[model samples]
Target: MSAKKRERPPVPEILPAPVVDSHTHLDACGAETAADVAVLLDRAESAGVTRVVTVADDIESAKWVVDASTWDSRVFAAVAVHPTRTKDFDDAQRSGVERLARAERVVAVGETGLDYYWDYSPPDAQQDAFRWHIDLAKRVGKPLMIHDRDAHEDVLRILEEEGAPDDVVFHCFSGDAEMARRCVDAGYVLSFAGTVTFKNASTLRESARFVPRGQFLVETDAPFLTPHPFRGAPNEPYCTAYTVRNLADLREEPVEMIANAVRETAERVFRLPTVTRG
Candidate 1:
């Protein structure tokens, strides 16, 4: 029998306004094929994702992330061991992470913080690894990208004790108003993701409502938390528009206004040269 030709899916449409996905993990999703990067970037660029910060959950992923960012000018990198993988941060791994952090494509350190919900790693080890990443970011003079999953108190405490850099961000923020206020008070940027669009996200929405215009950012965290209608499907960077729209609705503002805010905050946090980093 002759092989059947695979159908080409229609190109995903772009949002009318520009945006910047401040956080994502392009290299991790199992479904994302090698060809998807360009196609995904094309769709994202069309949908106004001028830039994206692809976070690495561990030392090895950081290298792939760097390679992806290097291959595509639109993508930048954040490197570190996630809380779940804190056990992986042995001496050799720690040194390698530090070296990767110093890479030109690495703009921040993390996807690292506390994840008490999973507790895949010991709490003490997570804390130690979190502190190490923060210190590495400080030493390298780069920003810090935090991932706090149901461990807000511990995350905040560590950041305070470590004296988090001026450019700290809670990527995929899922905290309450108080946490939002604390982050704002500490001058940390909050990057919202697809989860913000979930119906049960009142607290997250409340936090988003309070985030200052400039201190707020948006992202896809794609190939994972597919937003709303796309939920249950494997997410891609192109679907970020749904997140942008959801954010605008929650903010009771025009999509364009939120788009501009997202772009601005993403540039500030990621220090991308294209947007208003000033």
Candidate 2:
């Protein structure tokens, strides 16, 4: 017998206001060309996910993301060599990422930081690459998008040591309430992904509740982390609609309010152009 295939969740109703998926992987989400990107974005727009910041995880993706951003007005890009891939981040890789980071549509330098869960890259190498990315963000005047997994303490210490960029966002933030508070105090924005909607993610839920407006954002990290009820299903930018609704319920705020707050925060943090809905 064959294993069952998970069904993709039906797109939730359009949000009351537009929101942004602060981080995602268009390439990983099965988009290979401009038309494929459009199909996904079209679904997202219907659900009121007006814009997205597609992030890169390696040198090839860094280049692809920059090109994808140019293919559509609603798409923006973030380029970085993810922590696990930094084991052999040579000069060519560094220069490639740096060059792409300067692209007009590349709004942030990130999906970078330490990942202790995977032993793919040694801690020392990850830390070194992280520091370099921090400086790159500062030099390019862009927000630093982080990918902190289980190495919260080290990630924080390194940021303090390197003098974090003007804007820093912990993408798919996995810390507890105290860590959230620390990041908030330091003016670092926490971006919640579908994990916050999991039944067992009480700590993440608590952090979501604790983060004040303007200090937090939402993302799909899609092609992964599909919101609950659709947990194992394939995820895309459109699924962000489900997460946004769940967040409103979690925070006990109106849906439209949560939508507007994250949208505004993303625009300011990424310096993205204001998206006016027709």
Candidate 3:
């Protein structure tokens, strides 16, 4: 057996307009310290990605995002136990997450939803946690960022049954055009990642085309899902430009247009903070 080869594409030119990475994992990206975070964010800023919403897939990550958001004006936080890890969700963990979710800079409740692809946890447990997170988001009056994988039907069903939060985002959207239309009709925002740029992702590209400019967002989901020509490479927020540019090309729209749309949508949904202190 041999190790699979990965490509590391050079960073593309900076985007013309600033954009935001709606779903990324700062800690997983190896930005464990404020200094490391600053360096990563600086590279992203130089590439015109001025803001980011770091998401937590577990409790420790949830805590980290909350603390990191306070350190960097450009960072916002989204906290939740991911679907695969929802097996660990309990009263104590929920209480901690709830306390942090109400923190000044925590903007959304998520990276939570259903993932049938990986059976790390049983289906019912995942659903239970998903529903709980939904309730928490509604009560807190914050947007919900969903992580739907091979379980789209169940994910949507749960949302409908629970009366989804006022603002819902499908981070790293992985559905076909029809699902995209449904999400748009239901007022859910779809966040695109580098996967949309892959050759085999025609359905994703179609879904992107079907999305109205204001209803879609762009993200890096960094430390994973690197864009085409660079797929399999370690990802970072600075690589957001590549995904944004590819999205623009896919939609046959100007790069600046896509950038501005995502940036504005992110600000509205996540209530981004100023990148500099007043």
Candidate 4:
């Protein structure tokens, strides 16, 4: 007999207030068409995740995310060639990402930075791509959403060398308290993913706890990093609720306060318009 399929985690209770998933990959989560995207967003909305910024990690996904943003009023897009995929990031790819970055629905230039954890791309190439993206974000006057993984030093160095953009977000921030302090001091927002709720993530939890309300945001980074208890389960934007609650409990703050803080920070950083739910 075939092995039984694992079930998806049930959606957590609705948040006290709506929150935004700062980064996710709807395409990777099996969303192909507008209807498919809507289905995912519907589930998220029911759990009070009223808005999302779907990020692209490659040229094709860059185009898809821009198009997907138009499919739903609550969806936004962030475009860039992820560091791991930057091994062959030529002029054509850069231009393609640039065009998509200017899309009305595209709010940021990101998921770009060094990922030393994965040996998919060399350090020089990743740094080169990271610098280019930083410049692109500056030229476009949009926030830069970074994906630093085991490469915090080089990522920070490159951003400084490139004269860093006005707004920067460390998506799925994995650094400890000291790094968090550095990022916050530099005025860069740290967007926490489900990983922060992991039982063994004490350092990460410390970072999360100390980040001021306006300096932090929340995300699902879905189809990956499902919050604790559902750690390995299929994740989606709706799972953001669980992370929010966990963050509140960890920070010793009220759920509504955490929800409102992240929502406000997301709107300001992404320049998203206020969303209303019936």
Go through the candidates in order and give each one's C-alpha lDDT: 0.80, 0.94, 0.89, 0.93
Residues 133-163, candidate 3: write the lDDT tens digits: 9999999999999999999899999999999
lDDT of 1: 0.80
Q: How many backbone clashes does candidate 2 have?
A: 0
Best by lDDT: 2
lDDT of 2 by residue, 78-195 (tens): 9999999999999999999999999999999998999999999999999999999999999999999999999999999999999999999999999999999999999999999999
TM-score of 2: 0.98
Model 3 ranges with Cα > 4 A deviation: 1-8, 273-278
In candidate 3, position 192 carries an lDDT of 95
The ten-residue window of minimal lDDT in model 2 covers: 1-10
| Residue-pair clashes per candidate | 1, 0, 0, 0
Model 1's TM-score against the true structure:
0.91
Per-residue error (Å), model 4, residue 39: 0.5
Worst 10 residues of 4 by lDDT: 1-10
lDDT (tens digit, per residue) of candidate 1 on 133-222? 888988999898888898999899888898988799898898999989999999999888888889888888889887889998887787
Ranking by lDDT: 2, 4, 3, 1
| lDDT (tens digit, per residue) of candidate 4 on 30-131 | 999999999999999999999999999999999999999999998999999999999999999999999999999999999899998899989889999999
lDDT of 2: 0.94
